[model samples]
Target: MNDQPLSGLTVIDFSTLLPGPLATLMLAEAGATVIKIERPGGEDMRFFPPKSGDVGTLYAMLNRGKRCLELDLKAADARARILELTDAADIVVEQFRPGVMARLGLGADELCARNPRLIHCSITGFGQSGPRAMEAGHDLNYMALTGLLALSRGSFDAPVLPPAQFADIGGGSFPAVINILLALLQRDRTGKGSRLDIAMCDAMFTFALFAQAQLTTLGHAPKNGADLLTGASPRYRLYPAADGHLIAVGALEDKFWQALCDAVELPDLHRDDRRDSEACAAAMAERIASRTAAEWVPVLAGADCCATPLATLEDAFRDPHFLERGLFDFTADADDTPIPATIVPIDRAFRGRAGAIDPD
Candidate 1:
């Protein structure tokens, strides 16, 4: 842990919920001293349901390695304490709406002025100057505003909610972490700090790169579930097997597609899917539906066709490949009982010791 990448750094986290907390969690895992400043009663996430002992599972997972300080920022003493911390802090992460921090006399400009080398990262639903900057929003709202939700929709009557918080993590937390690190590198050279504006909606556009390219070139928007990678092609889709489990197919390349056709014994007319995609997809579905996922597993496993049964959460947790990779080596304490910590994408070389933070 002596060689941890962020060993000597300190981060002041004034954010709550998934995006900001998850971002600081990564920094904490990298050996930064993250002090999470919460309100007098603590953040709302602390009281969220499905508690493990006295701590919420989600809260414990997101805040595993960070120290907590209860502070009512509106109070004079609280404001004074924050200023004192800011003077010595290397990074500050805040998730308030635009102008909230400035109104409290704790804006990035004020804090960065105090700590010349500090990296101030602001994560918001919209950029500080945008028309929607002050508008109330969440992960779904950000995804909707960026056209990401329309790309892979459900039925006409009801759209499907994303299984994960793509905007919160991919858009907000990831960009904030990347920028903060870049800012630190910049500070090392320039001997000055910089403020990063991470608007979750702004980053969501990157997720739609393929759709945007199609729209730009064809002058037409792709229909929901009809785009090549969305669900239109037989090569890339989910087929329900006889036992109700689903088989995920990703035979996109010609070789893989040919292998899939051979395994399913697809008719020649449907083999060239580009000629009539709907027919081809139907034929593929019929063949896959005839057998259970277990029955098809061995047949597709050796075919190199990129086809496999869809796994549930339990299946994923017990996956042999992930277990061998040491993905669950780290543990977080829930009322003194150790549980697998949230898996982060950081490399083992850059991470600190397991259970590095004091849970108390």
Candidate 2:
């Protein structure tokens, strides 16, 4: 038997791509029995790029600790088999266009009648009842619609994808997991199931908490890189290194900002709350551009000023803090090939952490 918190819970994951798979993987790591019902051909992400000779690193990493079964979901037999599996499942997640589930007679209304204790979650680009519910979209599309793309908009004329999957995985999938878990807890008292309709576009809007707060109170929304937190202030922006590398800075609080100025030998910076911020920013940028990433990394680390050199994904894996905290785990595939995975940060002493899951 597994020793994890969710050891006995069974999850039927009928979703695809990063979002759904990632959410289920977290549950699997918590020792839940997560069964991945892939389409007849295979998981969609199996064909995603950056293949390792022929294997998908992403697919392997996300599907760990889960059994994959191929099923033609449109087939009658597949629907019946799905119902059979979901009947015994504690939770079900399906990321499809809104009406597809109902068309297949597998809607939450029907599923809950079959299993009253089930937590059925539906993740889609738009909500189940929205006017745009049937319109197809990706992460960028949702971010664009929700006005979140400007959070990372660059100076270049071209648009680029955000380094992270903010909408699909962050908004849609993770929210589904959190809500489903909440529903499960509620089931203990209410003894009933519920349906969760997670719209990625709607989820994208929540990403603007601080910006929205500013808009509400200040009566004006800032543009790309013009907001205080978005790089308008010298203390909260990135600087390019001499070697084309970047250093991120975020000395926001007064104390932190004071420390940063002290570390940079610019103690005068503390006195000028309205000092030509643009000029200061320009000076800081030029100063940072004088050194390679190697020369400034140690200086920033010693300053406690919330400034650090940006590292690429591969190099980021070697960061000592994450290593010490067990953020990365290595697993072996069926052929004994090494599969590197990112372990959830939950720990025995995680209570002090704000977003840590509660223990029963």
TM-score of every model versus the real structure: 0.97, 0.90
lDDT of 1 by residue, 1-360 (tens): 767999989999999999999999999889899999998878998878778887777888888878888888999777789999989999999999999999999998888878888889999999888689999999999998888889897997997999999999999899999999999999999999999999999988899898889999999868888788898788899999999999999999999999998987888888888888889889999999999999999999988799999999899889999999999888887677677788888898898754533432
TM-score of 1: 0.97
* Index of the highest-lDDT prediction: 1
Per candidate, the number of residue pairs that clash is: 0, 0
Highest TM-score: give the candidate number: 1
TM-score of 2: 0.90
Candidate 2's C-alpha lDDT? 0.77
RMSD, every candidate, angstroms: 1.3, 4.8
Summarize candidate 2's per-residue lDDT along 305-354 as a digit string, tens digits: 89888888888789888788666544524223665664544453321111
Measured with C-alpha atoms, the lDDT of residue 4 in candidate 2 is: 67
Clashing pairs in 1: none
